[model samples]
Target: MKRYDPALYAILALIFALSCAYVPLAGRGGGEMTIEVVRDGKTEFRAPLGDVPEMLEFRGPEGYNAISSVEGVRMVSADCPGGDCIRAGTIKNAGESIICLPHRLTVKLTKESASEMDAVSY
Candidate 1:
């Protein structure tokens, strides 16, 4: 029969606690942005934009699509089955987006910028 060592268990528990403590520090100074598509006040699609084109092709299963740029964001396509989202074209701004009535999807862009000092905590 094999016996478990209490010291080993304690060390493993300590390691897990340290890792959990560090999780919040991972986001110290890095900014994150989420683009959400909504219709009738319901969220449909969300995307992160490092560039304009990457945001253009973001799509969700519920017939939602979104695109974004430094200036704005919009919906370029959707799978609402009526193709209304496709006609909306592109939008480049913070609060700009396109919605499809049939599919009940909306696309919007959000940005988050954190100060560099936050990194020091990590």
Candidate 2:
């Protein structure tokens, strides 16, 4: 049996970690999702997935609406008459949305599609 070198193991671990990180950045799939808040058919807020605040508040004609994104986008509180928006549940997947008809507000989750496959060139 051959002796194991500590440096070799560290190098291998670093390489593996880097490769894993690169795969997601290469646009293969599983890209970061975006949160889009639309009010009266206009985009009130739009941001890419990142450090989401504990509570995101938006002003509507009815009153204020609050949402959170700890795990996924969800309505935590609202001033609307009906609580249907709160019952919409957490929306994490792209195309999912929570609508508050009374408030005339909509929060939707979306993601950017990966680029087309690259062809090898000699």
Candidate 3:
């Protein structure tokens, strides 16, 4: 077998680190964002995230959830056994989501369109 140099491993490690760091940033963008509530693959609620009512309630298979859509979207409270969904925190970025497995519920943020500033003028 041919012997390999340590430099090769170091280069691979650097590439992996940079790619992992960029993956999260790639999911974020400046645009008009909306909150989508999906239950069992069906869209139940969809609205501008920041413009939604201060408090919204949803009934799921497991129980109920109180959602807050102030500046961002979040599950303020839920009747599920585990409070993981509520602990998922606010989702202000496009492509972010909170899933409640037991309740078969998902709250996601979607970008309606890329902001004009993201375009380059010739």
Candidate 4:
């Protein structure tokens, strides 16, 4: 049997840790993203799957009437009474959102993974 070298072991451990640290984690594969909107602040909107056109015609109170892609994610059309929220625009990154004060609605985007994201709060 060969003698164990403590120094060699420590160096190996350090290399392993450094390699793991540099390796891209599972959630780090994509660019930073977020969705921001205002919906009474109590409820949040789900990130839309399709493009801006598809989001416009969903046809629901919470459905987005006017949407814009500020960055990457889609800001769905809102049902705010004044139609202000509808015109707020789209967001797709950390720290972007739309607000509808009249209806107490807001939309915001975050860095959480798409699957993990509960709702795109703008």
Candidate 5:
């Protein structure tokens, strides 16, 4: 039998701990979702997806883009070619997005967790 190296085991354990530390625990419940509007590669506006319906307008490079949200989020009006953004009906979940290439604009839904994890462990 070969002898076990203490240093190797210690390193393996540390790696495992660090890897699991960032894993979000399940059953934490759903978080609030928000719509982030990006223009010119920068976030220009953000709004919460709540009960009351809302309409937002943002000035893009070419013109203006209008977004509406009630139960979910959607781009209601825009001058972008094909009006694809308007076709992206509604998104209620995290990681969903809508983009308009002509206007160089993007709308995304992001979940804001109550207990957010840190990027690094010190």
Candidate 6:
């Protein structure tokens, strides 16, 4: 007959409890998202995730640039010489970002809290 160690049981219980606490947060990532556009180190525009896809245009020292977002965000167009931002592609996750150095622009996606979503919907 094998005996179970109390210390091992306690560790397993603790891990189970921690995993339970983490599941809800882990599942919250696909919640509503907001778009933040920063230019020249300042936030230039903020908007809710759009249902219809569209491009947002901006003019900077480097020239014109466009950012687009629907369920996912991307740099659709830019006048920068290398056009690296345009190639950065789509980002759908919170904390993901795309930067255009020539234009000093940044586009970031962020998850919205349940309370904030409720307020917006109502």
Best of the candidates, lDDT: 2
For each candidate in the order shown, give its overall lDDT on alpha carbons: 0.58, 0.84, 0.82, 0.54, 0.78, 0.78
Per-residue C-alpha lDDT of model 3 across residues 12-99, encoded as one tens digit per residue: 9999999998976675666777889999999999987767889989986579988888777788989888889999998877778888
Comparing 2 and 5 by TM-score, which wins?
2
Q: What lDDT tens digits, residue by residue, belong to model 1 across residues 1-122?
A: 55898898999999999999898766555455556756568664455655335545534445454444445554555556777666776665444556666766666555554332222221
Q: Is candidate 1 or candidate 5 better by lDDT?
A: 5
Q: What tens-digit string does per-residue lDDT give for candidate 6 at 1-122?
A: 55988898999999999999896676355566778889888998887776434877888776888877654788888888898998998998766788898888989877754333322221
| Position 1, candidate 2: lDDT | 57
Candidate 6 whole-model C-alpha lDDT, 0 to 1: 0.78
Instruction: Quote model 4's TM-score.
Output: 0.45
RMSD of each: 11.4, 10.0, 14.8, 6.8, 10.2, 11.2
TM-score of each: 0.40, 0.66, 0.64, 0.45, 0.63, 0.62
* Angstrom error at residue 74, model 1: 5.2
Where does the lowest 10-residue lDDT sum fall in candidate 5? 113-122
Q: Which candidate leads the pack in TM-score?
A: 2
TM-score of 3: 0.64
Clashes of each: 7, 0, 0, 32, 0, 0
- Badly placed stretches (over 4 Å) of model 2 are 1-30, 114-122
**Arrange candidates by lDDT, highest first: which order?**
2, 3, 6, 5, 1, 4
lDDT-best of 3 and 4? 3
Clashing pairs in 3: none
After best superposition, candidate 3 residue 58: deviation in angstroms?
0.3
